[model samples]
Target: MVNECAPKPHVALLASPGMGHITPLYELAVRLVTQHNFQVTFLVITAGSTVAQDSYLTAYPIPDLHIVDLPPPDMSNELLNNMKTVARLCYIVEQSIRPLRSVLNGLKRPKVKALIIDMFCTGVFEACKDLSIPVYSFFTASAALLTFSLYLPTLDCKADGEYVDLPEPVKVPGCNPIQTQDLMYLVPKSMINEYQQWFMHVSRLPMVTGIFVNSWEDLESVSLKAVKHEPFFANIPTPRVYPIGPLTKQAEPVLTKYEKETIAWLDKQPKDSVLFVALGSGGTLTSEQLTELAWGLELSQQRFVLVVRKPSDCAISGFFSAGSDVDDPIAYLPDGFVERSKGVGLVVSGWAPQVGVLSHPSTGAFLSHCGWNSTVESVKYGVPIIAWPLFAEQGINAALLSNEVGVAMRMPMVGEGGEAVVVRRKKIESVVKAVMEGEEGKKLRRRAKELQASGRETLSRGGSSYETLARVAESWNIET
Candidate 1:
């Protein structure tokens, strides 16, 4: 129990840009406040912030949680536009150091005891170097990815050149072997050295006080075990690893007219009948891929709700343009595709209420980009996946879901040397048909439900995540 006589220990959570990063940190902050009796200040690094980010935060409010947006640095759009996503995220964090330190120094009321940072914002550690407070890393992805990352430094020394060119799959003990193309955080060839150096710097465990991964023991026991117990890591100076999640936001009641209408349509569908296709907030496909997906859905003759984005060659083309003005994605669909599949499908042009849609009874399967947030949400709602991973750690996540967890069937990318990166319409149709009608779909559904139940169990009172967070909370109190 919290010591009622003592003041609540204060903590600060730093979130990087993107809904994938912000959502989990926000949810984790809420849990710390409500369940662990800690006061939390949520610090958002406001570089390239999105409208969806603003709307999501405003939707959920808690009295104990104080939200702060760090001043955006005066970086030109042209400069930011030229850099890739990872480079941009890193640059933003680097620029925020001064303002971040000022925010830390200014918080005097029940002075902050610990600061937890998003994985990308590790550069801000420079700001905290002189402070007495401890800094923790909140890894918002799976433990499997975490294992792979921590093992990268070793892989770097042994491998000759680019990881993408490795002839065989990369192996981490006790985890699924990762294919070369499926590697997380692989940058362009020109930036490989910089990227490797950056990851090597972060992999050294003594840098942070601990790690808070958005995963549970039941979801990733083997990878979690490898992080803690593997002989390979015994020599490394590892930080405390806390698997304290499935920390995803629950669907609030629908307020927007579009959301209400979407939910209403879902309500009318048969149970486990409609396929929900969304490629997260940032994922987009090439026009060719988009056309193939449309025709595939039409051919399957199955019910679907597809959230379409303006097609681009870059998979993450929608990253900075999430809620920005542009042409409707529906206009880009194959000719007569929407009209022909009108009753059987609903094509939302921009964003969809993912949590609400996944929770709906008719959402039997999800065709997702397999972003970690989307992955955890689908698992929480017991929705099997058609794992169509685009970039970042998504490919790793897809491997985990389809290979290790058995909760998803991966969509294969067919091409020579990654030149042709599209899955043809026939393959898309077959996967959709299998997921909706084949025996494999039944198996995936069963596994999804099993993981869903395990997720709930791990978050309940006296459960693994609950106990871990409680212990961490008590430690912060003691440190203060």
Candidate 2:
């Protein structure tokens, strides 16, 4: 048992802007405070924060966790808005280093023992170094993505041209080759160089003391093995990797009207009968694609609960402004689409209680953007997936889930002449059917349940993830 008398070792955790980054890091802070003996100061970047992120922080005020919102960066909103997502985020972190240093200096009582930063906030390494504090990275994505990031620096030195125009698929050791078009986020040609530079800088794996990946061993054994024990990595200066994850939220209290209505709808449906469709906080479909998706779901004739956002020209349009807008997302659908699908489907605008919906008995399959958080949550609930990835490492995640993990059916990228073009309604309808009622769906569901059981075992006492986190916590104690 942990000593109740000693002053807790203080750890400062820095989280980036989006919900995807904020949620996992916040969960980690909760675990550090509640499970292990630690006092955490949770720091978050203020620029580009969304309503969802704000509401999440306001709702859960933990006892031992202190949330510190750093002042916004020096860059103007107009200039920041003009840059691409990766560029904007990198700029935000780069400019906040001085303020971050100030925040570190001001903390009194038990001084911070270690600082854990988000993957995007690696630029703070110098600030922490100046303050004589050790830094670790809280990587919120998969171990597979980490593997690719670790190997990318070598590719940067060796490759002659931009990755978008490569003649063949990009190959990472011990994993399947990926097409160039599916390279994380698709940057416009004008901004490609900026995106590439940001990735190259962050991909330097040896910069941190260690990495805490949000994945467990059973779900990503091959990639995790390649990262830790592969002989090819021996020559590289890699840090210790810990797969202490499948980290998820505690059961949230049902308080909002939207939450109540969503759960009530799920309760009315028959067991294992409904499909839950939600893109991540930032995943958006184009206007044409949104209409097609609506038609497709209507054609599939499956019971579905879809969380819709207003369509935009860019696939990641909701990244900065997901929940802030007041417009009805249903306005973007095909004419009378809501009326036609009223009895068969329910469409929610903006956000829904994802965990509650996923855990509902009526939820049979998830139509997801394959964000890491959504992917792990589906595994936790034993819900099979129709993987329709949109942006930012989601394609890699979709492939991992479908080809390697056996928990999802891959939705083929279909358009008239190019992969970047829209996916027609027929293809969407077909994949939806395959995951909802077909033979392949059964296999996916069975595998999903098995993985769910495995994940439960890992998070339980004396399990793999449980033991891994305990060991890390013990090391922190020794350091303090």
Candidate 3:
């Protein structure tokens, strides 16, 4: 195709089985191919019976971006349910090495320059090393989480015992203070036993030539400085860190048949008036919590679109498949909730057209689960958040967004024993009103807008994110 002129550098991007990981990688690939002129091949690990991959490809098909699927691990349903997700994913990736090696050996033209892998897929690091291919770790989390991962090695979790029971706020060198409850509430006990395995993975981080994060400098300058300058990290000989992010989805993402109806409904709402609610893929609430959320939105007197998930479904079971046209979510809702707020709210069960809703002219605020992707999207659109964290790194993000970033208001959650507690309807109404109308809401809005402008600026030509990718491109040249 190039007439033996300028050969395109081929780079492989490896994504594990989750929307949280794949979405950012998808954004990064788009920029790399269209903006930087690299040929990207995605080596995707097959997920269990989820529709995430199929939906993403169907919704946003970049034919220029080649894909090769690695075989799914033959995990037994019973064992798979009990095993920690990270452990299972990492183990599955290890099993796929034979096939991956065969594929790599069969390569002809456009040789792979580097393998950029999700942090969870650390098995590929060694394979790349043996094959003389450049390898990079991609952190899909916030800079704060990445910093924590680097610092985790230094802290003695074994001596301290369980994550939540730690006496004081766990402090990472040069980074923000993290409370035990906020930081470790969702960490599985299996992670403690697997610390040796985790260390084996992260210890390999510095061995790579570079580490790519889905974040930008302006967004987390303080945390970033800690990551780069902290004396604790100095002992490790860390990789060249690249904060080449804000790679969140653009507003108005490609539409699916499911989204068409949602978009049409949104079209009728007034400008800067509707509140969009959806917890990111892994978030779910108990039946009681749902009732409060419904009452809260109704009492706020705000126009809204809520993406409700089926309570019986597996957590982390979403990528592109949320709700299709076949399911009606109304059955599970609170009694008379829909009839009481007919025109005022549109409640749909399943996945929502998130970016489309975020980018709409009528969208005023986002009530999010505080997942990094949702956080980035809200930040990208200048929409203030009602930070409602349920699990994983969401608590860290909620702390960052509400306390550090000033772009959101944190919800007061009282969950315990893996059961969702009822957040009072009054608390919900207050937070909703605060973002939808009050002066405090206005302030949050202004800050979010400021972040939005900076986020976009960094992606523009000659901007920081743009230049950061330049370094990544240059790294590709070293091997080619």
User: Against the true structure, what is every candidate's RMSD?
Assistant: 1.9, 2.0, 2.9
Off by over 4 Å in 2: 1-3, 184-190, 414-418
- Taking all chains together, each candidate's TM-score versus the true structure is 0.95, 0.95, 0.92
lDDT of prediction 2: 0.83
User: lDDT per residue, candidate 1, 1-480, as tens digits?
Assistant: 856787788999988788998899999999999998888999877777888888878786888798888887888889888887777777777776558778888875788888988777776676777767789988888898788778877887888787777889999876668888776335544586448545744675458989999999878888999888887765676687999889897686576666677898999999999999999999988888999999999989999999888888888877776755245766889988878987899988678889999989999999998999999999999999999988878888988899888999988873567443678889999999999889999999999999899999999998899899999998888874
Candidate 3 runs further than 4 Å off: 1-4, 157-159, 190-200, 250-258, 312-327, 415-420, 478-480
**1 versus 3: better lDDT goes to:** 1
Which has the better TM-score: candidate 1, or candidate 3? Answer: 1
The residue-by-residue lDDT of candidate 2 on 321-354, one tens digit each, is 7566566866898889889887788888878889
Ranking of candidates on lDDT, top first: 1, 2, 3
How do the residues 314-373 of candidate 3 rate in per-residue lDDT, one tens digit apiece? 344443343332466676678898788778888876778788889888898999888998
Using lDDT as the measure, name the better of candidate 2 and candidate 3. 2
Q: What is the lDDT of residue 199 in candidate 3?
A: 60
Off by over 4 Å in 1: 1-5, 192-201, 416-420
Best by lDDT: 1
